[model samples]
Target: MTQPAKRTKKDKIGSGLKQQSWILLAIVLLAALIDYIWYDAHWVIAKSAALGACLSYLSQAIFAGFVFWHTGYRARRHIVRQMYRGQMVKWLLTVFGFALIFITIQPLSAPALFIGFMVMQISHSWMLWRIG
Candidate 1:
């Protein structure tokens, strides 16, 4: 059989970025839909779940933004430093996001909220698993 065509660094990076973003969205939406139907959620529960999932998605988006933003860098030190900064930024963003959500939204469903957040976070494993 013929070998697959080799991908350039740009192609590889772009593919993974797009794949993960699209897949993450799909997984979260599917999960939220399932949650809504299974729980027969009213507006409060449904809104809480959406907010939680949005926070989770925002964290990953921050990480991906920082990582991809520096792909043009040639220095290894710069790349490593940027990655470290990305982790810190992601953490801070997550904390802020959760705080903001909790502060603004009343009568939040902790169980549903966590379920949405955790489900989105756990999707990363399946994404990586498909690669290896």
Candidate 2:
């Protein structure tokens, strides 16, 4: 009888990371598309685009937090490690900081706000390429 092939740990990790990167990429693309359409239709003002950009930034920050948590746990097998805690705190701070910036600048530069969102999406795509 022939035996089924077995997957190695590296293969499993690679596949998982690939799937995660793809999902993240998809989210970024969808958010960008929504922002673009809204802006083109004048459904939202520049300030609103800035607000949306802030939301996208916060979303990415949250995703990074989750990634750190999982990667730390998998690498060290300790959820309470200092690195994990530090990353969590950083993630929270990043989200808050970007949100504050968005609110403060949205009313001043709505088009710039939309540009910020596009930059973030591009950055995410670059990161995914590096990681995946």
Model 2 C-alpha lDDT per residue in residues 47-109, reported as the tens digit of each score: 444454555555565555444554422455543464566567656765676667656753445
Q: Estimate the overall C-alpha local distance difference test score of candidate 1.
A: 0.68
Q: List the residue pairs that clash in candidate 2.
A: 46-110
All candidates: TM-score: 0.71, 0.33
Q: What is the C-alpha lDDT of each candidate?
A: 0.68, 0.53
34-113 per-residue lDDT for model 1 (tens digits): 65687764455566666777777778767766765554435556667878899999899989888888888887877767
Best by lDDT: 1
- Residue 109 of model 2: what lDDT? 51
Displacement of the residue 28 alpha carbon in candidate 2, Å = 2.5
TM-score of candidate 2 versus the correct structure, residues matched by position: 0.33
Cα error of candidate 1 at position 8, Å? 8.7
lDDT of 2 at 53: 52
